[model samples]
Target: MSKKPVKKQDPETTGHSWDGIEEFNNPLPRWWLWTLYACIIWGIGYSIAYPAWPLINGATRGVLGYSTRAEVAEDIAYFKAANADLREELVAADLSEVANNPELLHFANANGRAVFATWCSQCHGSGAAGAVGFPNLLDNDWLWGGEIEEINETVTVGVRNETNDDARYSEMPAFGDILEEEEIAQVTEFVLSLSDDDVDQTMALAGATVFADNCAACHGEEGLGDKSQGAPNLADAIWLYGGDRETIMQTVTNSRFGVMPAWNARLSESDIRAVAIYVHGLGGGE
Candidate 1:
């Protein structure tokens, strides 16, 4: 018997055609269709179980009650609980006692650095070096005393702040109104001489009498500054405003009155102590 050739079957069409090309009416595979349906069902189930829809006032609260904010709050609570003991000890202990304990000191310094970056870096530079008007914490110069107790007091009460009754207060008279331009120039030269900067000896000599009569009550006779009066030392090269002749003239003529806010009302007692320790350890504290 001879082998017969197999006949080819024609594929079905959609009864539509364009320019002699016919459209095929092919059915999708059953497995692929089922998979697509399964995905749709899963998406619907997820929408019902969790927050999905948005309303005018807020978002949907699904049956599962899942919330990102609640989870974050729980994490914060856990962290605070874990560090409660150390935080409590830091709050209760004296600043010196905190410094004596190596572990506590380390913790305070680390926290203080973070606090300084957040709160103080705006005025004092990130390095605590300070700017033109701000006082540098890294040097030995201090308008107020630099001891831990003193630093704490200054930070708590602040300088020239009206809100705090115990704030460090001082007033520099604007000599532009009191004295003539010639007298102001004489005093500027005298201020420069205190720092051992080269100046006209004759002018400085004349200003020495003027200084003794007017400025010595606040600035010591030697220009070493009186911490009690919050007067800055004129003898030191460190100038809060500037060391140049023009700047000195300006200071003498107009005077300088800078203000620092009291931190006691803004920060907790523990936070104030920590910052004091951090500032004191910056190689300047007495």
Candidate 2:
């Protein structure tokens, strides 16, 4: 028998499907919807209070004026203020006076030691043991005099700064300029001989006159260098420049210059005094 024709269904109301699946028209949970809305609101608030967006010229500055550098500067100023009185007292007192006062000297030395560790330690080394080009602070050799006043002056004005009136200025003329190369060699040998406990008497006898006429001006008549010019004493074993024959030849030919830095503006008076005391205490102090 023929089946009755299937009734036509309207597309809007039809629940027909090719697969075994059904569709439903439903709304999302109210809490979920509200949570999304809250996120957007919070983002906008954050942008306003904090640096969030990029501009053509620069990034936006946050409402709170916080900066890393400003904090550091403030900390430094606070520390400086805390030490102002001590710094003032140190500046007023003479170096000798500072040395005499045990309390002040101790304070000065503590400060100076720290400063020395930072600045002087690089060349002079820790404990002022010295290096290839640097002088040993523990020894009796004072290239420019070891007296406290002398050391203070050396630290203040320096050894070679032309601008400084009190700079320890001494120049050893190159004998090679006036003397023959053989004479320069002879004097160099003689200088070396002077430092040696067992030197050739014959060679030294010949070189003595050469030393007197050409070298005596800076390196005293006895080969003991003039400290006023930072000239190292040859009579002793310590040599600021060097003690080798080749080194002496070079010094004789080209001349030698030793430089000490000026610390007047950088360091305080008490600090320098402390350094002088510390240096003096190091076995070599007079």
Most TM-score-accurate candidate:
1
Count of backbone collisions within predicted model 1: 0
Candidate 1 lDDT, 1-286, residue by residue in tens: 9989888766799999999999888889999999999999999998899999999999888899999989999996897688677778988897877778998899788777877888888998999999999989888788888888898899899999999999989989999999889888898889899987589999999999888888998998989999878898999889999999999999989999999999998987777888888988888868
Shift in Å, residue 231, candidate 1 = 0.5
Cα lDDT of model 2 by residue, 1-286, tens digit: 9999999763452365658755543456999999989999998877777777899996666676655667899996896688777767877777666767787777777777877787788888998989876889887788778776676677778877666777778777776678888787777778878778566667677788898987787778998888766667887877666787788788889887767777776776656765765666567646
lDDT of 1 at 185: 88
lDDT of each: 0.88, 0.75
Clash totals for all models, in order? Answer: 0, 0
Model 2's TM-score against the true structure? 0.70
Q: Which regions in candidate 2 have their CA more than 4 angstroms from the true location? A: 1-72, 97-100, 268-271
Score every model by TM-score: 0.75, 0.70
